[model samples]
Target: MAKNSGRGRKSGGPSSRPTKPLWRRIVRSVFIWGAALGLLGAIFLATAVLFTMRELPSYSALKSSQNGQMIVVRARDGTELVSLGPSYGRWLSYDQIPQVMRDAMVTVEDRRFREHIGVDPIGMLRAVKVRFERGHFREGASTITQQLARNIFLNNSYSWTRKAREAVLALALERKFSKDQILELYLNKVYFGGGAYGIDAASRKFFGHPATGLTTPEAAIIAGLVKAPSNYSPTADMQAAIGRGNVVLGLMAKNGVISQDEADAIDLSQVKVAKEEGQNSVRYFTDWALPQLDLLLPETNEPIEVWTTLDPAMQKAATAAIDNNVPKGTQGALVSLDRDGGVLAMVGGTDYVSSNYNRATNAVRQPGSAWKLFVYMAALEAGYTPSDRVVDEPVTIDGWSPQNSGRSYAGEIDVRTAFAYSKNTIAAQLGNEVGFGTVASMARRFGITTAINTQPAMVLGTSEVRVIDMTRAFAEVSAGGTSVEPYGITKVTTTNGEVLYQHKSVQGQVLVPHYVAAGITDMLQTTVATGTGRAAQIGRPVAGKTGTTSSNKDGWFLGFSSGITTGVWMGRDDAKAVRGLSGGHAPARAFADYMKVAVAKRPVEEFDTKLQLPEWQLEPDDEQLQGDPDDYYYTDENGNLVHPGTGTQYDEQPRYDDGAVGPGPGPGIPQVPDYGQQNGAMPPPAANDDFLNRATGRGTAQDPGLRPGQGTGVVPRPSPSPVRTSGAY
Candidate 1:
């Protein structure tokens, strides 16, 4: 009505259109604001994607970074022992992938794998909703392609940044590679646990075969490892892995990869995880050989296979021997070497899971009478035959006297007899006769690596030694005096069948004369036949020596039988003593138990040469003869016959037809503790320090060593860290 003159326009006022409904105006305003916000969000998301892509590695770098191969260690029998570093199986094309494996991977990992373009919005939204409700990031919707990209191009870190990068890389991979190619790469590079990185290696590792031969259930089992490798690996836990495999089978049925009946019929419980060398026992050998491998080859990233000389069966036997024989509170170690010095078995401790200290190769302790081996070896090399006669009375060095145990001396006995009896006095006399310098040098020449103390007491093994060194020394003797250096690796090759390194055996130099070695073997035979090492007998020819330290701190039995030199040691890690423990009791028995299984595969072998030592026989008139058990008579300190365990003495002496003087042969024989009887049952713990020092004239500022045939109490210096070089010290 106001538009009468100016064409319906109001002058001096705002112009306006016809008024619309309030609801329509409100909807229009809301639409305009929503459009602006949506544009802002789109721009922000594009900037974030670009930021994540800034650090993205090139797709070609994916295969290049994984170019480095795994280091596989195998036993002598070609059984896999362990794998070091990223391990992958042979790369397979899409066609080579078993249908079961492909379906199992797809159905269980990503239900919409065929439909998604790198990232699935539905799966991500569902996963996000579930995670938000749960308040913890547990459920994941990562596809196979996403996992492949994550493993190749990124670390397994849980962060928004990592997720952004993984998503960007997945999109890039999807854009470049075909679905089949992407699936092939994913299956070939995914980690399936057990130190394996891919389906093929995991297949061979868990099933001892190739992926081509994987059964449906086996494929399901392996596919299940993708989600949680350490928890689902058959080698880690069989029951858990089987349960996971069953879950996969259910998914396979739901996806129609397998019929429900087929999935139900699959017995994953029958899945026998390949029984490879995963025992903690083999860790000892692998630990020792790892350093050796480094020395043999220049460090590189290329995959290498190390073929070692370890006998898996023998390793099991050795571990069992230590676990069964070593006392509960104490520790034990054993090192066995072949005739060529190849390490066959090594057990550092009873349980590697409990304690990984490699006692066989690392621990440094007194050799006790085991050092007498070098002393006697020095004597034998210094022109003394085993048959040579030596007085078994007190022998002094720096005013230190070596006496027989319990002061029961076998006077003027032959060297063979004294050695068989492990007479402390005789050992010291020989050490005195043959300069201690020569004895220390003999130990060095025989492969004792620890620094040797050249003092007079060194002959009694005052210096510390390693079980591997002792075993190496014994291996030389077992090899008929040829020099030996303990070795394990035999060949190094790549998975591609290219030989990287092969051992070329060097001719061994003679460490001792053949006849001298034979002479030592002669006395060693006597020791095992009638001496302190009688318990180490394996019902066949064996030569060994028994060693017991002061206060029963350590026990040792070093021997060679059937071309294998094995050394056994039993003691505490902290150098504490085990009461009533002796070399002849536990250590020797352990030696026998191990050797029985160790030599079972080899033919019975006898020492080819024997020294023409005199036959030791107790003379009829001599007092060394074994008396009848009925003839035991209690004797007073003054040599008068008395009742058993009582001081009451009888002056009257009985006569015999043989005309024995001191005590009659029948009922008047003196009852004395038999210290030299087969070295059996760890004759009640040795006397205290004062009595032993007075008896052996020991106890000097520099000499903490015990008498020979008795354990040494030398304080062990802090041991040097184990050197892994192949060179001898």
Candidate 2:
């Protein structure tokens, strides 16, 4: 009936279409709702499984950051001169940890640290709310594990990804390790500024003690530094550091770790904030010593402990000498290398803490007269004896005229005296007599490896050389002519106590005997005795040379005792010429000062006695070899030669033949064969001389062919061969 009236009637109120079969409808409805429920149940199950099985991520493993142990430096007398890095951050077990330090860390950083798992949900939610309000993460809600993980594994950069990574790592770390393990690591990993890296470093850097030795107030002060290091640094801001310390104390008091009355009673004024010296520890030494260390021990990458030949007392004494002795505008470096090439002490610059450039090893300045040693050595080896004389007056060579330091010369002096006085002309003359090649070769033997221009001017100290090179050369002289390569590290050890490497002195022969070295040493001693190096003379036996470059631009003092060798270089850091400064002034004084202190405890002894040598061969007089023309030439010994052509014999006499007695003790001139007569033959033997012929038995007593000494019998000779341009001897 409704269908019949559909055109005029409104659509059926509830069911316009034909209703589906009851069973089909019911089944369809049940399938739709059931499929939706099944899908929801599967998602819930997957989420539950994920929550149960998921594992947090791990972080980069941190081996202990505490590097080396306190290296002790003692004097030659076994007296402790200085102690370096005395406090090492040690990871302590729960039982060994001091209660006061633990409580201070807990009270200051995290109040409910022990009660929480690895994270604090409420604290994180609060941080999230703050971040939402600020539109960025301005504050942190890191749990102790999270903070420790960040401190040890990550650097300070605020980011969501890093934060999430830190959280994952912290959760993993907490699951794998105990709370005490995390806390102990955190204690050792945190930075306390002022060159302090860990709790122990902070303790020593701040309180002049170890973490285990920290008092309650001292612990609070150190704990307070973790918040903002530079701001809470006692040296930088004492008032703020004290306020932070007081706040840490109040927190400890409120947490029942310390009594309120006890905290209030504590006087911050009496708490001595021991100022850290902040030694940018041996920056210069580190720079200079590393390359050498690498050479000495190249097998491993671990740092080698260079128990250098550095004498701490000498180092202090040297620093003081440079500070007190050098002029206001100049800076200097002083180095003392042991006979074995160990660096006993080094002051690379005026102050290593202030500057890192090592002028002593790195600066290549003109060596001045110091370079003359090589020149003299070359001359000596090339047959120009040290006793040979040379004029010290100015002489031009190769269109270059070199002048002495004072523009005056002491003429006609021996090599030793001239060298002691640093004569430029005599050195150049000797260089000319020998050759540039010989001089350069000698310099190379002395460890001058870099290119040295083989000019005659080089003999006058015009070439540039570094102090380390000269020091090694001079040390070899001190050690008896044995060339020693310089070394810094004695040994290197891994963190696990395994020996990675050790250094031994490697030496080579540069001279024939220790005597030659001793002679050189003796000559150099004269340099200190009566020459420009007189300022370097110490109470004991000392040998050295002083060098002042042109216009006094660079000053140098190289000195050595029985056991140590030192080189001092002084100049302007900018290479600008300094006025009125010479090696005799500040560098020599610095060398002397350091030597006096460094050698105080060591026993006084002469050089190794075995190095001394005896005299060498001496040549004969000149006149004896150059007297008469007849001495060098052969002539007839008899008065005349008889000619048999005529029936009556005719006398054949030379025109120049007079009773001159010529060169020999004879009545007439000794006969020399005429050019045509001796053209293809060796000359006949002298009238009264006994001669030996290696090729034939013709002249000696053992040979039957020899002529008699006086009136004589005929001597038989060997068969002759044609002579070339020169006759056979």
Clashes of each: 3, 11
Q: Could you say which candidate leads in lDDT?
A: 1
lDDT of all the models against the reference? 0.77, 0.67
lDDT of 1 by residue, 443-512 (tens): 9999888999887777767899999999899888888788988898999998998988898888889998
Q: For residues 343-381, write the lDDT of model 2, one tens digit per residue.
A: 777777776534446777777888887887777766555
Tell me the alpha-carbon RMSD of every candidate: 20.7, 18.0
lDDT of 1 at 252: 89
lDDT of 1: 0.77
Candidate 1 Cα errors over 4 Å, as ranges:
1-56, 59-69, 87-279, 612-729
Overlapping backbone residue pairs in candidate 2 total 11
